[model samples]
Target chain A: MSHRLRILSRIRKALDAPAMPSETARAEAVAERIAHPPQHWPLRSIQTADPEGAAQLTLIGRFKAQLARLGADVIEVGSVAEIPAALANYVAANVADDAAGLARIRMGSDAFLAALPWSSTSGLEIAAGMAEAADVIGVSRAIAGVAETGTLLLVSGAENPVTLGYLPETHIVVLETGAIVASYEEAMQSMLAATGGRMPRTVNLITGASRTGDIGGKIVMGAHGPRRVAVVLWSA
Target chain B: MTARTQFDADIDTALADAPLQRALADVPAGFVAGRRRAREELLEFEPLRRVARDIRDHALAHLDLYLEAFESNATKAGSRVHWAASGDDACRIVLDICRAAGARTITKSKSMVSEEIELRERLQDAEFDVVETDLGEYLVQIRNEKPSHIIAPAIHMRAEDVADVFRRQHGHLAPDRKLDTPEEMIAEARGILRDKFLSADVGITGANFLVAESGSAIIVTNEGNADLTMSLPKVHVILTSIDKVVPTFSDAWPLLRLLARSATGQAFTAYTTIVTGPRRPDDPDGPEQCHIILLDNGRTELLASEMRPVLRCIRCGACMNHCPVYCSIGGHAYNSVYPGPIGAALSPALAGAEQAAHLAEASTFCGRCEQVCPVEIPLVSVMRQWRSLALEQPRSRRARVMLHTWARLAQHPRIYRWCAGIAARSLKWLAGSGARIRRLPFLHAWTDYRDLAAPQGGTFQQQWAQREHKRAQRDRADVSAARARKSDSVP
Candidate 1:
């Protein structure tokens, strides 16, 4: 056969793959707070929380390993109170008397609450009130895999703002080991089933950074959003 | 500063530039390296090329479907879609939009379609401040020049040349400044453009891929200017050819794969922002109004011709980057906005054969463009087609007569041989002793670098035939001996 014919045949095959499941089922699978995707809500909760203390320590170690692989500069603070100190030291060392860098960081991060001069009780509400707060706040969603691209899906509930995934540069995703899904199609099916085929108001499946090559064929990363991507995978 | 539309004379002048020749010479070495790197890194590179080719072919086949889908989707998303059947129509549409928006200052990203329609002149005629945002484009724009290389608009410019231009243009602003380095120059441009980005009323950009499925126009850029251009401006206008539209995102993926690698050997663009529509009500930053001008401009007509394969071009500039002729003359030598191999084919299609006749003659027909074309556009063939078209014009009476005289004389072998013999004798006599002529009126360009070697006493064809006659006698003797041996053996 000719080269064109052979290529057309391959495309036909890719398009003709059997329908896996309903879109609702895939969406539900993606939205669930499992360690991975596809386990029932009750069963996933069991895996997300260690039955004993043994698995909890093991999962913490795994989270640290993933962080190292992602090449993020890690700082382990004892509590939320110490987070301000950690961030200040980071800002001082990296950025030297630059308001622009400070502004960028403030715009990028979701957890910029403790450092601001708000009253002790006011906390995150003040950071959220900032005009140019992060573009998206990413939350961890246990989805199978993306149906089209192999993107990690995150759904927003009441605690998790939808903007976390899209707005913020630093995606402080608290992912448990049980939340990994196989494919996007399967994740979509689960998501659909859980939501009764009604997709979220804002669903973000992030693969990489916000990039464009519009200027003289040069690809500049982080145009509107955070150029820096930091993922915080932790035990449930 | 303005670029001339009458490119024929300007191109002839640029064809003589020395620095342009130097720049062209460097094209092959870098292009080979970049393409090889991309191929090695992306295992799916070839597959993506095939997929992209198929997608483009499919789209071209069913273009009406996708065009309708794109129009409706863009319209539904609150973007006004305008149809332009010609380059003039496209320019008129953009000018009308600018006039209506009260756009005194317009910042434009690199759009080949805009260049195709000579948009800057049109906009300037209407008295609008049009600034080119792309660095290479900015350099070319400031100098009142057209792009020489499609990808690197200022590829032919030397650092010293650029420094001089900058000094002349920006000396008053930083009169005491001593600028020497490229970094300094870049910083200066960045500082100047920072205010331009914010103050612009309208932004015009080019689309890499127009996704019909979601009514999104994808612009791939390395600089953050596109985002600023789109977000800061009240009115965002996209000038794109009809061929840019694709069926869906799935189809877009393969083309994107080939485009980056073929253009600059990047795995992916730094920013591949997909603008779906005008900013939503709650959205903080984005254009209030979006308009996508779908410029046909003889593309549909080209699609109906033998040169239809030329539309498969993703504008990667690989062909130009790899082209020997393009490297030497630079883009200005071609005199048309689109230069290099793809330009050689396309300019004639968009512009009339009469206007762009000289462009087709710019190519060496070396087939480098075709070899490096990711979508496999038969660039050389298209160029040859243009050559034939030019030849058949019937207007060039002198040229036609000359060709006719040569053709009529060339038919009779005896006459042609006699003419060749006389010409050879004269040429041999002209060379004092060494087979070199320092200067000859008609042959000056040909003999500039190297001398034409004198032919032997006889033509190769005649010499070969004589040798064969002698060899046939020897062969006959051998055949007789072999036949005698065979007869003895049979007995």
Candidate 2:
């Protein structure tokens, strides 16, 4: 027998000792659980019963608060058009001046980011591709924001490559205000709905900039990833 | 020396190591205290823990079905799924994949399963330049030492020790560079590892959870190295066990919620990546090929055994953080890939009772591990089961004899009380005025470290009997007085 068969048979034998349901019954039970997952666990911080707009607002508020606590910067812009200026201001303030004196922003070919008016902002060099080693700042668009944990859900594809999130010292995530959700469960459901039940190649639920406490138990941010994660939350 | 004696010597050596002692002191203040704060902040932590346990149990109960589901879904998603019955088999499979990819350089994130299989040494022996990307794991790699702690691999080393190691290994750099703080060390390691990430041909990691629903492999990390590992290389391989599979994304959320909180007191880790398959055809960047190696490594047998709850461990390290034995001796002394309460129960189950019985006997049954476990695994009970299995061995003749004598005496209450009273009286007499015994005959192990407090002149049974008699007398007097008061009221 093959290793897979042998292993499965071993598991069956082990589980056979107990008086369990039939094999068909077990398969049915698994299928049932997967088809209809349980409701979201009640999180005290976010009220699930609020109106849609209010709930989104609550999620955005909670999301910002959680991110702030983790040392992330959240910048809210009035509209998509203001993002370039916001990004430019953030870069000027946080990122150290390089020898070029121009901020280089590397990003994937995401439609949402590409549609933005970036040429209006001066001293900003924009490149549409995967991040490189010398890239100082990388920007990507998040599909959804999780409120309870302040997480960003980024799917990997040609539109938003996974490398852009980890390679740069400064990571700028573009999250629309309407895309913020109350919990991971809702975000997952939305993702499934968007993909027609087929999962994307990669789904990254990023909470903050990369950090490590392995050295003397002291937390040092930007360990092998972005040191700073700046979320530009824009509303229409 | 016998295994028992050698373990004792290890304990003594660990206790005497001053640097280790200093490092161990941080466990309570770091992981333990952090978990407490995280748990306190979440109002639904207790209920969520129960949900997490149930999810794990349900998956394990029908593991065969879930494994099949995961295999089918993953294969459909363009990922090649491989099965290995043991660690050696898993290592060979990984090497074959690397060889097929013509991988000259391999970068790995922190994967305890990979460590369990000793995969790095195997790969390096085949001349693959393997690099550990996690900061803690990188430090341990440079020192040529096994990780002393699961979450914090270099927990045994001080900042200065790390600096010395870096200085010695990175000799091409200036010798007198100031690497004093963790910040400096982190920056230096990051710069060095960034090049490895960009240059590696294959990246390897371990999955915390495998979603049977979508055929996704999820890895949780505070550092972004695992992301870079899976993203940069042309080939990505995930080394994980069969027990990591969950039914759906919903099932994964609860476990994810408990993991970071229990491990480091964070609401969420910095990165939780779920990879369904290889990169899409149009993707700008990601591993072109993805492989999932499902390793059994004696886990199926473990599932059949009475110690099945040991499989519920999520590798949070909370059990170890709260374990008294672990806090004292540290992870190295356990001499197992996993260490502490979970290790005590799991090592015996995986390696067999006779070979690793000393690990089971190393616990004080303080119950802190179970108390802090996110899955609520009965760790103490599992360790006790291992102890029972150990007693049947021929080498446990002395222990069996002592237990047999105690059991016989325990069956008869009068004889047990009489012998216990005499023993307590003698101990009290030996203790003199201080009521502390500085030395004990045939039990120097207990007295060698600290003075054992003498029993207060009698056994527990004698003291309980006396208290019961006095309580009965007091109760009768109170009833009679209540009756007298009622008669006076009637007159």
Candidate 3:
């Protein structure tokens, strides 16, 4: 017998309580388990009213605060048209007066990046691809954002290259306001709904800038990923 | 990767290492404070832990079924699933995959299973250039040392130690570069590893959880190196055990909720990546070949035995973080890939009782590990079980003889009290006014570290009996005085 068969048989014999199920039976049981989700999750709604009443503003405020708390900066804009100006403002304020004068960035030219008017930002070196080691900043789009933990969920694809998320000293992400969810469950539900139950090749849920405490138990940012994560939030 | 059956000697060495002790001292303040703060923010923290525990239990109860479902779906999602019955088999399988891919250089994230199978050494023996991408793992790798803790591999070392290692290993770097802080050191490592990531033929990461429902393997890390490792390489391999499989995402979130809070006290890790399969046909940025290697290295026996509560471990390192023995001696003392309470309980089962029984005896039975465990595993009880099993084997004749004598003395109350009373009186005589025993036969190990307080008076039973007699006399006097007062009132 193969190693797989041998190991499985040994485990079954050791268990010795019931006969091993067939593949069909196993699939059914799995379906049953998935259909009946486990309980005791703290993510349920406590108040029984419009979840979007005053809580929408509360969630937006919480999301920005939590994101800032986790070493991320948020720039809330009124619409997608204002995103380019917000991006320019963030760059001019934070990265314009660098040791090299202006900031250099590798922006993933996804649908989101393509939508932004390029002529707006002057004196910025922005290329379209995965980030290289020499790149000081990376820009990408977040598929979704979680308000509970201030996390941005990005899907890996031809447009939103996965490397653009982590391969920079500073990472700036474009997030649409409508995609923000109050809890991980709601975020997951919306994501599944959008994808039609197809999980992306890679789903990166980034909560904050990269950090490490391995040396002398000190919290230091910019370990391997971006040292700074700034979100350009688009208001619906 | 050498397995030391002499756990006592290793622990002795660790206890003597002043640097290790000092490094361990910082653990309580760092880990405990973070967890407390993270938990305080969440109203559902305790409820999440219960759900996580139940999810693990339910999954393990039907482990065989879940494994099959995971394999089927993962295969459909364009990933090969390999099974290994033992550590040797696991290594051979990984080597075969590397050879098939013509991998000359491979980068790896933090994987305890890779440590368990000694994969780096095996690959090196095959002349593969293996690089550890995680900062902690890379530091340990450069120093030619094993990980001290599972998560925080270089927690035992100071920043000076890292600087020295970098200077020694990366001889090509500018000699005068000031590497005083972790940031400078991290920057240096990142610059060096960036080239390796671009060049590595394969990347291997450990799985935190495997979702059977989605055919995805989840990896949780603060550093984005795992992402870069998998995203940059041509082939990505997940080296994990069978127990990581959960029924679905519904089951996984609870464990994820408790894991980060229990670990470093983050609401969520900076990055929690869930990789479903190999890169999609249209996907721009993932490995073309993604493989999952499931190793059953003595875990099948654990699943079958009464000691199965241990399989519920999420590898959060909370148990070891709060373990007094671990904090005192550090992870190197355990002499296994796993260290702390979980290690003490599971190693004897994994490595064998004869070779690993000393680890089970290393605990103080304080149950701090159990108290903080996300799954609420009975860690003290498991350690006790291992100790009992060791006791039955009678490995050391002197230990067995002493235990047998104590058992005999403990079984008889009259003889025990009589002997205890004499011993107490003699100890009191020895102690005098100081109230401490400076020396005692067969207990130098205890007295060596700290003084044993002398018995101030007679045996506990004798003292209780005397107190009871005084109470009876006082009660009778009170009753008689009450009767006298009543007769006077009547006259």
Give the Å error, residue B228, model 3: 0.9
Task: Give stretches of model 1 more than 4 Å off.
Answer: A1-91, A98-104, A108-236, B1-12, B394-398, B413-442, B449-491
Which of candidates 1 and 3 is the stronger one according to TM-score? 3
True contacts kept of each: 0.04, 0.84, 0.70
Worst ten in a row by lDDT for model 1 chain B: B1-10
**Comparison by DockQ, 2 against 3, better one:** 2
lDDT of model number 2: 0.89
Q: Given the true complex, what DockQ would model 1 score?
A: 0.06
Largest TM-score belongs to which candidate? 2
Say which candidate scores most in DockQ. Answer: 2
Interface RMSD of every predicted model, in angstroms: 12.6, 2.7, 3.6
lDDT of 1 by residue, A60-171 (tens): 4433433343233445555545544444454445333334333233221223232333333221222332223323333233332221222345533333343343334444
TM-scores of chain A across the candidates, in order, are: 0.42, 0.91, 0.83
DockQ of 3: 0.51
lDDT of each: 0.62, 0.89, 0.83
lDDT: the better of candidates 1 and 3:
3
Model 1 docking tier (incorrect/acceptable/medium/high): incorrect
TM-score of each: 0.70, 0.95, 0.92
- Fraction of true interface contacts that also occur in model 3: 0.70
